[model samples]
Every structure is written in structure tokens, then in C-alpha cells.
Target: MHWGYTSIGASTYKGFDVSYTDLIGTFGINFNLFNNDVVRYYSGFRLGLIWRETTPFPAVGGALGFDIKLSKFYSKIQFYLGMRLWTDYREDQKNHFYGDSSGYKRGLITNNALLQENGAIVLSMSW
Candidate 1:
């Protein structure tokens, strides 16, 4: 499940989030466990971008999380938790070029669309 809290003034915050998951099959799938009492641990890549407004800083960031599945019979539910390694907004003009770089013109200072740090968690139910 993804969630975020936006601070309106000082002690107030507006928050929201969303998440989804998919499960193809249980016993018919080769990835299924041979025993019924098994809880399967799975790992894959997670990638997504988020956009937030009215935030202290307008930012964007991608997320990465690990996934695990708990199963019984033919039904299973998966949960994910991970972190993002980059930011999502152009917060400031850090490495931005404002002018020419060939020593011909004055270079302008600006913030490039640099990445930021972000993360999220997710869960899914399937059979």
C-alpha cells in the first residue's frame, strides 16, 4: 500500500495513497510450493514514479520494493516494501546551465531535474 502525508500549515496534513497486485495461479503454476504449509518468498524489481503537489517541495521519485507471498490452498496474498533511490522533482537549480559552456557566454545557474530519495509499500490478494 502506498501512502503520503502533505503538511498544509504546521500540524495539519493531507494524505493519500494507492496500491495493487496480481496473482496468476497457485497449484497450476510452476512457482507454487509442493507443500500446503509453505509461505513463498519472492523477489523482483519494482519501479514507479510519484507526483506530489502542495508539498514543501514539488517532487517526484521512483520506488523499488521486495515482494513476498503467503499462501494456503489455491489462494495467496502478496506484500511488498521497498525504497526509492532517486527524487522526483526539480527542486532547485543546482547543476543547471544558464549560459554557453564554450567560454563564449555567461552560464546561467539553475536546478536540474535531479533525482531524490523516496519509497513505498504495496500488497496484493489473489488466487
Candidate 2:
């Protein structure tokens, strides 16, 4: 259990990321929210896969979904649902107890084909 941020360089413009990693027994739960939203209330949550050295940013393992209400100009809400293609990661130090096998590598998998099995839903209403 820990929390912190990383700076790529010494400049006003910087990438920010926060994560929560919990290893309890044989299972774990990881949840993170990225703030790339043009607006403050439009951000989303990435829930799944905890922290892994291979990944530079937190990710949502397994099935994932999110909903966003773009500014107020639009009458419809944007929704998204998808599943992570999984990854194959290996630890530098060989430790058989934890199995160093992964389906994909961190950073290697992004908005590419790995996250392609995704869908979007829109509902419009006038108020």
C-alpha cells in the first residue's frame, strides 16, 4: 500500500499519475484515475492490474468501462466499455513462486489493437 508521483523532466509541463497497489493473499485490487480531461469533471477511472514495473502508467486489467458527460453543450452522454487484451511480463529476478508470465508488457499495450475490443454508447435527451 503506497502513493506518489513521478516527473519525467524539470519543466512546467509534466505528466502526472497516481496509483494504489494492494497485495493481500493471492488476489489484489488496483484502481487509478487519469486526469487528461479537458474539463475537470470529465476524467475517468482505470480499475484493475495494480502496479507493475513493466508499465509506466496504471492500467485497467480484465474488463473495463467508463462514462463521461462532455461539457454541457451536448445533450447526450458518452460511454465506453472494453476488455484489456492482457499482457506477458517477466521480472528481472527469476522467481518461480510468483510466476513471471504476462500476456503483454507495460506501455507496450495502449489504445492500439490490444484495447480494440471496445464499444461506445450514447444517450441523448433534451432538458
Overall lDDT per candidate, in order of appearance = 0.30, 0.29
Cα deviation in Å at residue 123, candidate 2? 15
Minimum summed lDDT over a 10-residue window in model 2 is located at: 2-11
- TM-score, per-candidate, Cα-based: 0.28, 0.19
Tens digits of lDDT, candidate 2, 3-96? 2211111112123232223221112332445744321112222233333343322234332232243444543443333222233222221232
Model 1: ten consecutive residues of lowest lDDT: 21-30
lDDT by residue for model 1 over 1-127, one digit each (tens)? 1222111112222452312121111111112246532333332222332223322323333333333554334534433233322233333212322133233222133233344333445454432
What lDDT does model 1 reach? 0.30
Steric overlap count per candidate = 15, 7
Candidate 2, which segments miss by more than 4 Å at Cα?
1-77, 96-127
How does candidate 2 score on lDDT? Answer: 0.29
